[model samples]
Target: MNTFRQHSKTRSRAVLVAGGAGFLGSTLCERLIADGERVICLDNMQTGTTGNLAALAREPRFSLVEQDVCDPVPRSLEVDAVFNLACAASPPRYQADPVHTMMTCVMGTHHLLDHCAAHGARFVQASTSEVYGDPREHPQREDYWGHVNPIGPRACYDEGKRAAETLCFDYRRGKGGGGAVDVRVARIFNTYGPRMRPDDGRIVSNLICQALADQPLTIYGTGEQTRSFCYVDDMIEGLVRLMRVDPAPDGPVNLGNPGEFTILELAEMVLDLVETTSRVAHEPLPTDDPQRRRPDVSRAETHLGWRPTTPLSAGLPPTIDWFAGLVQHRRADRRAPVAEASALHGVA
Candidate 1:
C-alpha cells in the first residue's frame, strides 16, 4: 500500500466527495472549491441529480465521477481526504430499494475505507440519527446504544449504518491487519436548507412545498413528536470541522442543533412564512419513527467548538423561497406544452 502523499505547499489538496450530486454533497463540493481545494465528486445519481451541481459546472477545480460506492473505486484518482455521503438518505428513496441501501451503507463503506487505507487519506462517514431509532433517552448522546429495530422496514438504513460505523472503527483499530485508516463518524440530526428536493418526503420539504402550493401539510402522528433542525450550512461546517480537527475524536460526535420543536410548531412556522391557505392534515406515523429526537451536542461543542448559529426563523424563509421558485418553475413547464399545441392549431 502506498503511503499517503503530502501535497506540496504550492499545490491545492484534492478531496473526493462521494455522492457529490446530492443536495448536501453538491453543497460540500462548492464549499471545497471556494476554499481553494480541488474537488472530485463521485455519485451514482440514484437519489442525486445533476441540477444540484449547477453552480459548480464551470469550476475548473471541480470534477464529477458518476459511479456507485459499492463498486471498486478507481485507484488512479488521488485524494487527500474522502467524505462518504453516498447513501439514499430520505425514507421514500432509501426504502424504494432497500437492498441497495443496505449495500451502500455497509459494502459501500468497506470499499471507501479500503481506498482510504491504500491512499493514506482521512475518511469521514456521514452517519445519521436514525442509528438511535425510537430512543428511550431524551437527547441522544454518542455513547447511548441506540434502540433500533433490526428487522423492521427501516432496518435496511438504520442497521446498515450501525454496521458501517462498526466497520469504520474496526478499520481505525487496524483490526484486520490493513493499516489503520483515519476515520471520523458524525451522527447527523435533522438538517434542512435550500437545495433540498421538494418531493424528498422530509418534514421540512413536505411542509414548505405543501404550503407553497396551497395544499394541506401532512403532519405525521399527533404532531407532538419533536425533532431538532440544523440548517445545511451549519451542518456542513460541523462536518468540515470534524475532518480538520487536530486529534480525531475518540468517538462519534452528534452534529445537530439542540433547539427542539414539535411537528405542529414547524408546520405553523412554515405556514407563517408562506403566504398560502394551506392547513395541517394529520397522517399516521411510520413504524420505527422516533417520538423525540434532539442531539446532545456537548461533545461537538467541547471538541470542535461548533454549534449551529442559524435559527429556524432565519433558515426557513430562504428554504420556503427556494421551494416556491421550484413550484413555479414546474407549473410553467406544465403550461409550455399546452401553449405550443394551441399555437400549432392556430397555424393549421
Candidate 2:
C-alpha cells in the first residue's frame, strides 16, 4: 500500500479539481479558494470557457492546468483531495463526440483514481442523476438499478457515468492489500445558474435564451417529462459536504433538490419570469430522453446533513439575469464584424 498523508482536521488542504473551468467546476474552485485552500484546476476546455475562470485567474491561491483528464495527470503536485468533474455533461455537447465522452467518464476517472490512490488523497466523483435513466421509480433512491438504453443516443453520458460509479467503488474496494483509495460519488441531478453556456442545450438555458430573444420556446414531446432543478450554490454545497465526510459513504449518494417540475411548466415559468412574447413550439423528443428525474437525497440529508435551501423562484431570477447578459454580449459580438465591414466600405 502507498504510504500517504492523512487529512488534518485543522488545516485547509491542497485540492485538485479536474473540470475547474466549467460552470459547476469553476464555482467549486471559487468556493474552495474562498475558504483559503490551495487549488489546482485542470481542464481541457472542450466545453469549458476561460471566461468562467476570470475571477479565479486573479486569485493567487488558484492555478489552472489546461489538460484532458483522459491523459495521465501530473504526479508531482501533492494534494489532500481530488475532485473528478471533468466530463462533458451537456447532452448535445457529449452526443457530438460520444466516444470521447465515454473515454472521459471511464478512462479519465481511472487515471484520477490511480492518482488519488497513489497519494492516499480523497477522491470525489461527480456522477450524474442520469444513472437513474428513465427511472422506474418515481423519486429515485441510491439503490435503484436504472433502466438505461445502452445503445441509445443518451447512453454515452448515462452509461459512461454508471461505469464511472462502478470504477469508483472498485477503487475504494482495492485489488489486494485492503482498500487504499477513499472515494465519494455524488449523483448530481439537474443544476442551473450563472456561467452556464447559453447554447448548452439544457432546458433551463434553452428556454431562458429563447425567451430573451423572443424566439418560440421549443417543446420536445408533450412537454410533460419532469426534472428536479437544484441551484448551483446548493449543488456546490452538497458536493463540498460529501467530500468532507469523516468516513465517506461506500456507494454513490444522490445530491440535488427534490422539487420536481415538468418541462411545460418550466417553460411557462421562464416566459413569465422574462416577460417575453415567445410562444411554445413543438418538436420531436430526442431518443432515450428520460421521462422523469428527481433525486431522493435522503442519504445526503442523513449523512451530510445537507439539503438545498434555495427554491426555484429564488434561483430563477439570478439565472435569468445571467443569461440576459450573455444574450446581449452575443448580440454585440455578432454585430461587431458587420459594423467593421461597413466602416471599411464607407472609407473606400
Candidate 3:
C-alpha cells in the first residue's frame, strides 16, 4: 500500500482511474478510497457525467481531471496504478458515435498504456463479455476466440476492446519486466447499480423505470435471452483485487456473476421488487443482442479467489431506489415552473 502523504483518512498510494466518473469507474474510485489509496480520476465526460462522482470530489484522497484520454494523458501526476475504463460500455452510447467509441477503446487505451509504461504502474483493461460476441460456446473461458461479426453495429466496441486487450498482453509479454509493471484484462459482464445512467437503455433500468410508472414492461423476444447481473460494488472489488495480484497475470479473466436470468424473469423480479402494478409486453430484441450470457468463474476463483457477493433480490432494491431518485428528481424539475422558464429560455 502506498503511504498517503496528505489528504484521506488513511494513507493511500497514488493511483489513476481513466473514465473514473462513469458507473464502473466511479464505483472503482469509491472502493480504492475505502482501501486507503489516493485516487486520480480521469475522464473526458463524453458519456460520463461529473454528477456520478460529485460526492468523491470532496474527499481528500480524490482528484479529478476532465480530459480526453485519446490525447496523451499529462505525464506530471505520478501514480502507482491505472484502471483503463474510458470506452462507452452501454450499447446505446457505444453505438451513438461508433468512430469516437472505437477510438476510446483503441487509441484511448493506447495512450493510457503509454502512461502506464512511463510510470511503471499496474494497468488494468476493463474488458467486457461482449468480446465473446454471440458466443458459440457456453460459459466462455479466457481462451475462447469469439464469434464476432466484424461489420456488425457492435463491432466498433467489441473489436475495439479486443484490440485493447491485445495491447495489454503485448506490453506485458514483450517487456517481461519485474512484477512491478502489471497488467490485468477483466472481462466484465452486465453489471448494474445506482449511479448508472437512467437513459442507458439497459434492460434493468428500462424495466424498473417502466414498472414504477405503471407502464407495460417491454419484454424483448419473449424474454428468453439470458444474462447475469453483477452488482457494481462486487465488480469493483474483484477488479481491485485483480489489479494488485502478482506476476502480471496477463489474464483474459472473467469477472461476473455465474448466475443467469432470462429477460422476462428479470422484469418480473424487478416488478416484484418495486411492488409495481404493471403489465408485461413483448418486443423485438435489437440486432446482435446475445441470447445467452453466463461467465465461467473457475478462472476468477482460481486466480483472484473472488466472486460476486450480492444477489439480485438483495441488489435490485437499492439499485431501483437509485434510479427512482434520479427519476423523481428529474420529474420534480419538470413540474416546477422555474424549470419550464429555464427550458423555454434554452437554459440547460
What lDDT tens digits, residue by residue, belong to model 1 across residues 269-296?
A: 9988889999999999999889999999
Model 1: pairs clashing at backbone N, Cα or C within 3 Å? none
- Please give the RMSD to the true structure for each candidate, in Å: 6.8, 6.8, 5.6
What lDDT does candidate 1 reach at residue 151? 95
Candidate 1 matches the true fold with a TM-score of 0.93
lDDT of 2: 0.85
Q: Which wins on TM-score, candidate 2 or candidate 3? A: 2
lDDT of 2 by residue, 1-348 (tens): 332235566756789999988889989989998877878888888877666766655566777787899998878867778999998888999999999999999999998888887777888999999998899998999999999999998899999999998888888888513356888999999999988888788999999999998999999999999999999999999999998887788678999999999999999899889978899999999988889999998899889999999999899999999988877666322212433322211100
Q: Say which candidate scores most in lDDT.
A: 1
lDDT of 1 at 155: 95
Model 2 regions more than 4 Å off: 1-12, 176-179, 331-348
- Can you give the lDDT of residue 6 in candidate 3? 33
- Order of models, best TM-score first: 1, 2, 3
* Per-model lDDT: 0.87, 0.85, 0.80
lDDT of 3 by residue, 66-169 (tens): 78888888889777788998988888889999999888898888878777777767788999999999998998888888988888899999999998888788
